[model samples]
Target: MANKRGNVWIAVSGVVENENGDWLVVKKKYGGLKGKWSFPAGFVNEGETLDEAIVREIHEETGIEAEVQGVIGIRSGVIQSTISDNMIIFKLKANSSKIIVQEDELFEAAFFPPNFLKDDEDASLLLQSFAEEMFEKMLYKIDGLNPGDQFGYTSYRLFL
Candidate 1:
């Protein structure tokens, strides 16, 4: 299937956690989200898989190599009544704690305790909500599935 209208945008984000039980967050350097703390995220490029996009985004924004653990959540909404945006949030495990922030895209990147974002004034509302929810309940995640050699697609990660 193809999107003939081209009005939809697909994005990916990661809730990355380190071994010490801290979460990774970054402050964007531009746009409406400038200076606000949020998880590393970006638009999924052409021909890229969802898991690949989340890992690439985390590395691009925070300079931390991470592996996708599972799919955490999905959010969809229409922006400005024209563009439909769909974002898939993934749970990631950081390979290393060291972060070399991408200066052009992010102002700062660091790991913080779970309770930090929920009360931080600079954190985005969505980030705060996620943090609060994480503190209160366990997030249901969809692990990757290895389909048999039946499907001809290059990659398949269905939330089942």
Candidate 2:
């Protein structure tokens, strides 16, 4: 199947925490965000759910298997009034600490201390703000409800 919607792109990013309370971040090797540190993220593929996309992206970028805890945030905006970019941010729990960064997509990958990005020069402002806000308050999350089939769409997940 082809992508019928060309103007809209959906992406997912995960904020994964290790057992030591360190957060996972990746440095992009290309694009405008080159050299900037942020959470592991990628565009969703056709037929992939947001949760599946985030988990896949996290593993693909950082080689860390993570379980989605819930959705933490969402960012949506229009680019040049032509393209719509929407990103879903998920909170994840890392299964292990060891990271094997993907050489093609990332410059580096590592776990950082809490609030590490707050004052970091190489971090994006949005990421910095997220770091601060995440630690400062309890975030409301949309969690998965049981029996996805109840919605009639087998792949549909109810988050509440």
Candidate 3:
């Protein structure tokens, strides 16, 4: 079966882990995800490579200069009927941990540890699960995915 070609709006995100295995995330201040914590991500701009876009997004959103460790995974969500966003996520090593959140769109940017009760802090369950799933894929390198060939990460369907 051949897949039909349609417009897939592609985006990129990064996973910058601290030495203690915590994940860096941001709280959105606009749109549907307002106040919910998520990773720093944005659309791949025209004339920019995915790598460059992810790095730029991380810096712009979190003020973190991240060295791309490897291509870790993929995340996708559909918006209504026509707009579907596919995000390519990478694993990064922070050159520095300093974060300067873009207050216009995000309220706070910080690292949150894993396996903690997210509901207590009002973090998105889906986003937390997404982080955990990507972490596991990064460790196991399942489907023979490497740093460069990172498309085999995982898929997600977000309701809101």
Model 1, span 8-58: residue lDDT tens: 989898889999878999999897789999988988888888889989899
Worst 10 residues of 1 by lDDT: 135-144
Pairs in steric clash, model 3: none
Question: TM-scores, in order shown?
Answer: 0.86, 0.86, 0.73
Winning candidate number (lDDT): 1
In candidate 2 the C-alpha lDDT for residue 7 amounts to: 86
Specify the highest-TM-score model's number.
2
lDDT of each: 0.83, 0.83, 0.71
What TM-score would candidate 1 get against the native?
A: 0.86
The order of the candidates by TM-score, greatest first, is: 2, 1, 3
Ranking by lDDT: 1, 2, 3
